[model samples]
Target: MLPSCFRNICKNSVLPKKTFGGAFSKNNFATEATFETKPYRLHKLDTSPSTTVTINREDAIKFYTQMNTIRRIETAAGNLYKDKIIRGFCHLYSGQEAVAVGIKAALRPHDGVITAYRAHGWSYIMGVSPLGVLAELCGRQKGCAKGKGGSMHMYSDNFYGGNGIVGAQVPLGVGIALAARYKGTDGVCVALYGDGAANQGQVFEVYNMAKLWNLPCIFVCENNGYGMGTSSERAAASTNYYSRGDYIPGIWVDGMDVLAVRECFRFSVDYAGSGKGPLVIEAATYRYSGHSMSDPGTSYRTRDEIQEVRQTRDPITSFKEKIISANLVTADEIKKIDGEIRSQVDEATKQAKIDAEIGLDELPADVYSQSLEPKIRNVDPFKPLVHKRLGAAVNI
Candidate 1:
C-alpha cells in the first residue's frame, strides 16, 4: 500500500533480485548501470591516463540521493530564512552540490574536512544529518553545535566548523592534517576555500609549510566564477588558481561535473597519501544564488548568463540525463526521489522551527575544560557568571 507517486514509480521499475557479494544489487529501483568515464582535462598536472570510470549501482543511487537532498535542504533553508525562522548570515549551496558530493565520495571515514561559510552541503556530506543542519541554521538546541554555531559554524566528527572567517579554515585544515600524520593515521585533510580566499597571504604561507613538511592535505579552491559580489576576473590578477600553488602541484577540474570531481579527488587522495606532498585542486564551479540572502545576485552577473549555465551545465540535470540515457534509472524513479527528498526537507524544516532554543546557562559549558574554571561576563560588570569547567569531567 503506497501513495500514487510511489506506486507508479515502483510498478514498472526493475529491482535487482540477486545479491552481489552479499549485498543487494538494486540501484535506486532500477537495474545496475555503468557508463564510460568521461575524460577530464587537468590543468598543470598529469592527466589520469585511465580512460574509463564506472558508476556502480549503489554509488550511483547514493550520489543522486545525496545531491538531491543537499539541494532540497538548501532550498528549505532559503525559505526558512525568508520566513525569519533562520537568522544571521545564511549561505545556500544551491548549485555547488556536485563539489561536496564528489569530494566526499573520495573520502574515508577517518578523513577530515574543513570549508568556508557556504558549507551546508559539506556538513551533510561529512555525516551531519539534514535535520541537524536545518536545526543549526534555525538556532535550535537540537542543532549539531547545540544551537551555538549558526549557518557558518556547524561541526561534527572529523568535519571541522563551517568557519566564519574568510581564510582561517585553511590553516586549521593543515593543523588537522598534521594531527592525522602525527597520530600515524593514513587520513588526509581536505581544505576548501573560495576563489577569494586564494589571494589570502595566509593560504600561501600554509602551502609552503604543507610542502615543506609534506603534509597530507588537499587545498581546494572552489572557483565559482564570482567572489561574493565581484567576479573572479576583477578580484584576481591571474585567474589560473591551480598554478597559484607555486611549488605545490595542482589540478584544475570541472567542478560542475560530479563524476569528474570524484575522479580528481580520488587521484588527490592517492597523491597526498603516498607522501607526494600537498596538491591544490581548483574547481571551476558556479553558484546559482547570491553570496548571501542579502544580495540579489543579479547586479553583477546577467540573468541570461545564469540561465545559460543552468540550462546547459547544471550539475544535477546533467547527471540525471546520464543516468537515464544509460538506462540506469527511469525518469519516474528520479521524480520519486525528488518528491521524497522534498518531503523530507519539509519535515525537517517543520521540526527545526518547533525545536527549543539553547539556554543561557549552557553557554559557558563548552568554553573551557572543567579543570580550569573561567568567569564569563554577565549583565552586571562585577558579578560575572561562573560555571564548572567541562574538562574536569572528561578529557576534551
Candidate 2:
C-alpha cells in the first residue's frame, strides 16, 4: 500500500492526474506533469554565430515521445512493405526522425511545409494521423490522400505533398512562401529536399527567384551523406550544401541532434520572418534504410558503418541519454513511453491492414477542378472513354 501522505498528495494535486502505464500510480508520481527549464547550448556545424537552445523537461519528454513514435511507425512501415501490404516505392524515414520532429517543433500550425518522397514522418509531424499515413501506404480509402496519392503523395493542411519528382516541391514551396508574403502574413514555408534534389536545376532557379522576391522561405537540404545509392562526395564537387545559395546566408546544423535542429530551425524561421529573405540550412543527417525498400543498403556502404552510426550517433538513443543524465525523467518513464508507442504503432498497422482498399472509380475523381468535367481512358482500348461530370458526388 502507498504511504498515507503520498496518497493524499496525489488526491490533492491540482495538476493533470495522468499515470504512466500504471507504473507511477503507486509511487504517486506524474511524469508528464513535471518540467524543469534548462539552458541548451547551441552547436553549429558551420561558422554561423551561436544561439541559445532552451528545452524544458515537459518539452524534452514530448520530443522523445514523438521521435520514438516516428521510429516505431517507420519500423512498422518496413514490415508492412516487406509483407507486400504496401505497394509501389516506399521510403522509410527511420534514422532521420529528429529532423522532421525538430523542424515541426519550431513552426506554427499555419506555417507551410513541403518535402520530397520520404515524407511519412513529416506528414505525421504536420498533424496527419499515423493511421492515415499507414492507410495511404496500403492504398486504403481512409488515407489522407484518399489512397490516390500512395507512398509518394500524402498531403495535409499547410503540409504539401511527398512529391515523387525530385526537387519539384522546391518550386511549390517557393510559391507558397510568395503567397504568404503577398497576403502579408507572418508565415514561412519550409522547403525540404534531399541531397540529390539539391543538385536539381529547378532548385537553383527557385532559389534565385526566392532571393529576388525576398520570400519568407527556408531551403533545408537534408544531407544524409548519400543520394540514392551514391554518396554525396561522389555526386557533387563540393559537399558544402549550405553555401550552395551564394547570396543567401546559410547555417549547417548537426541534424542528428534534435535540440540543435530545433534551435537552428527556430532561428531560421525568425530570420526569414524578419524579411531577411530566404535562408538555407544544410542538415548533416543519415538514413539507416536504403534509398528505397528494394536496395540492400549495403552495396555501397558496409554493414559496419551502418552499425557504428546506430550505436554511436542514433538521435533517439542519444536524446534519451541526455534526458536521463539531466534527471528530467527516469529510465522507467522512457521505457513506458516506448512501450505505449509500440502498442500504438501495432494498432495502427492492424487497422491499416484491415482498412478498405480504394475503389477504382476514385481514379477519375480529383483529376480536375470541381467546376470542370474530365474524361478518363478506359482499361479496354476499344471501349469508349468515360467522362466524369463536374459536381458529381463521389461515393466514399
The residue-by-residue lDDT of candidate 2 on 40-108, one tens digit each, is 222232344333354666788999998998888889899999999998899989889989988999998
Tell me the spans in candidate 1 whose CA falls farther than 4 Å from its real position: 1-44, 47-51, 368-396
For candidate 2, give the lDDT of residue 206: 89
| Pairs in steric clash, model 1 | 37-53, 369-391, 370-389, 370-390, 370-391, 370-392
- The digit string of per-residue lDDT tens for model 1 on 2-109 reads 212122222433322222223333553444554444344354565562434556656777899999999999989999999999999999988889999999999988
Q: Best lDDT goes to which candidate?
A: 1
Q: What is the lDDT of candidate 1?
A: 0.80
